[model samples]
Target: MKRKLSILLALVMILSLALPMMAGAETVSLAYKNGSLHLRKGPGTNYGSNGYVRDGDYITVLSKGSVWSKIETSAGRIGYIKNLYISGNGANYADGTSYFGGSYTGYVVTKYSGSSVNLRAGASTSTASMGQLRNGTKIKILGENGNWYLIETASGTQGYMSKTYIKSSAGSSSSSATQYATVTGSVVNVRAGAGTQYVVKTALTRGTTVKVLEKTTSNWWKIQWGSYTGYMSANYLRMK
Candidate 1:
């Protein structure tokens, strides 16, 4: 625990120091050919590769140099890439600004259920505030830069947020996350949506155990049965 705390503190301090240089950091896109461009811990191939950046991927150039450029990837990783691989071209948003794009899903995981996390214009804490997202809120993970994530809320609000406060799953794979229930009816139909109009995804036998993901409504609950995730009527499910 002490080691973890020390590491977290050290990382925060490092990011704090990097905030100024990243404040006005030039955002750019990668310009590599087929295959991925290696992101190294140092500026040269002599340095170890830490990650891969595809062609045209958005990156924030923290510090530019003649031969090498220190950058933060859209996935929140910091590394160095060759200067020749950096390009100024990218998709321009309606606001006339460049933003990263992604299709994965994630949820806000704050310290407390009532607490919220800040959204900013840039990855640094010193950036302009955009808004806040509350715990348990689902978001579209656009990309990550530094230790921050570029996310879009369900309401369409997009901005950068600390990556530490979000998770890829609805809950951790732990005993506490085991919200179990039993199929009450002899056989129950699990639909793709919350209503009968949706297609039946699968069928659950009587007394079959399932993991309840969310109680979408008093009548319908989203559940996980074996490998299937769909909605089942609450009337046919008895929470355990």
Candidate 2:
């Protein structure tokens, strides 16, 4: 009877220690004062835009890169958000685990005046205007173009607004290295070989960020990401 009791107590102690280890996993939240956010390809602003994320959204921090957090949206969309945008408001695990979040960091308009902006599909320029943006609204710019800018409105709408309407907001500057690289405006086919005649492996999702390893010519670039690497069209990749 004494041996059985000792065995039972030992098993209970082991389970207690194991339980906490399993419970250490957690989710994170996304919040900011400016109310606007950008989702990038790989956690830093250097990558191109995958989509726009708003304040109060919950994103799962899957992994951490130097200053960035690889997060997943409620819709299962995976992308990277700056550590400055995460609010780490939840309780920390007793196992010495913690996370991070950020206050609102502002963005700036990157172009001068008189730049033409194209309204994207599903965006209405008439009723869904870019927050009273006229030819010049002195707005906060999120991205740049040779002729336009991606801007955020006071009301949280993100669209291509003419750069001619806005100037750099106060305190909205970054290092030259932090400046965004232009992603190709067109979708390119992901192929199995380095030539156009190669077999089609798959169609890369629009807004996917790819690393250009080598430029075969003006039209093709050797690219790689994750476990897949091959030649893709230069017309599809933006310079970063």
| Whole-model alpha-carbon lDDT for candidate 2 | 0.50
User: Which lDDT tens digits does candidate 1 get at residues 131-185?
Assistant: 6878888887654454666677887756677767877654562112446678889
Q: Candidate 2 lDDT, tens digit per residue, 1-240? A: 999999999999999976643443333322212245678987566888888776556666778776788877766678887664555554211111110111122343335554444432111233123224433334434443333444455666545444333444334332122321223545567787767889977667656776555444234556776677776765556554
Candidate 2 ranges beyond 4 A from true positions = 1-34, 90-240
- The list of candidate 1 runs beyond 4 A from truth reads 1-101, 170-240
lDDT of each: 0.68, 0.50
Q: Number of clashes in every candidate structure?
A: 2, 12
**Model 2 poorest ten-residue lDDT run:** 94-103
**Distance from true position, residue 150, model 2, in Å?**
21
Model 1 quality (TM-score): 0.32
